[model samples]
Target: MGSATVLTSSWFCVLAVLAVLGDAFLPFLPSGTLVVLAVLKTKETADAPFLLGLAVACASFLGDVLLLSLARRGAPFLRRRLARSPKTAASVRRVQRALENRTNRAAATVVIVARFVPGGRTVLDLAMGHLPERSRRFLHWSAVSAAVWAGYIVTLGWLNSHWFNTTWLSLAVSCAAATAISAAVARLVRRSRQLSVVAQLDEPVEAVEAA
Candidate 1:
């Protein structure tokens, strides 16, 4: 690999970490787009695409743990802040129920799955801390979530690369795809929480809160 390629890859790697870090707490950011472009650049750069995924995943993991720590130390304040958004509020309710053993699903399953559903990660991470799960357990699940989420996102980018010849085009395609998936997941979760038969067995927490 040439020195210029190495330098460029380093810069991209740094940017990837920053974008991933931002996305951890602020899901609105286009971190997936940046990572997709970075992977596309790998064809001309010295860095391997998988390595970029690892860096992004580790940065994401740290961001999650950092947020979890903050929520753990300031549970009362964070809870009030998180409850302001309908999406986050719903996730918080679901997480709290699962963590309290009120739900049939396991807390770990909820935590791991929340990583993909934008805004869901923040709510569930906060819920875990609020429920006061062990630090060891939280970190373990956070790592798993980050790794799996990173793989899924990177795989999407890799697939896009095959369809587009240009980096920008591939990035645009991936971002659009990611946005669509995010919206669909959000809608599905919202509908299930409010309208599903399982949710009708008792008062739906999200529905009542929304009202």
Candidate 2:
């Protein structure tokens, strides 16, 4: 209702878009923190959080598309660089194989889940871009992931506001919580991959034993 609040909300939304978009390429940028700050700033403004969330989501989706396009255009060079690093190359190949083997639904699930894990989004996007056939599907799922991520992050900030009196405290607590969640998701993903590998290894042994 106030002019000051409106101006603050507008400025926060603009910063949120830049932070979210820039963080896609510059991993060091604290985009999540900025989102939380935005939530804190706009908490009193009617419908501000919804609009901010939508803006952040669109920015994230656009950033992902741009990153994927860059990766696709530089695929040959990226492949050559990866090839020089055997371990990294092998890891990328495994991800490609997994994507190729999975159903569209399952692969989309992976894309959605990867958005929660720190750094996972970048890696997966780059890997998906390297596979030209998979790029279109990646875009579709990226949009879903972006919206989900934006909502979840905004909710976290809003929830923190209920418990904390100060903006700095709310931002700090929310960011810490986000980091913890991301770490947990990364751990779960690693465990799932390990279990999958173990299952694959067991298949050959089971066949040998039966024969």
Best by TM-score: 2
Q: What does candidate 1's lDDT look like per residue over 1-211, in tens digits?
A: 6888768867776887798886656666667777877787675543466788898889889888877787778755555655555555665666566567533234455556666665566665666667674556767878988998888888888888888888788888898898888666555655664323222112212211111
Q: Report the lDDT tens digits of candidate 2 across residue range 13-64.
A: 7888898886665655788988999899889877877888899999999988
Query: How close to the true structure is residue 86 of candidate 1, measured as C-alpha lDDT?
Result: 59
Count the clashes in each prediction: 0, 0
User: Per-model C-alpha lDDT, please?
Assistant: 0.67, 0.74
The residue pairs that clash in candidate 1, if any, are none
Q: All candidates: CA RMSD in angstroms?
A: 6.1, 9.4
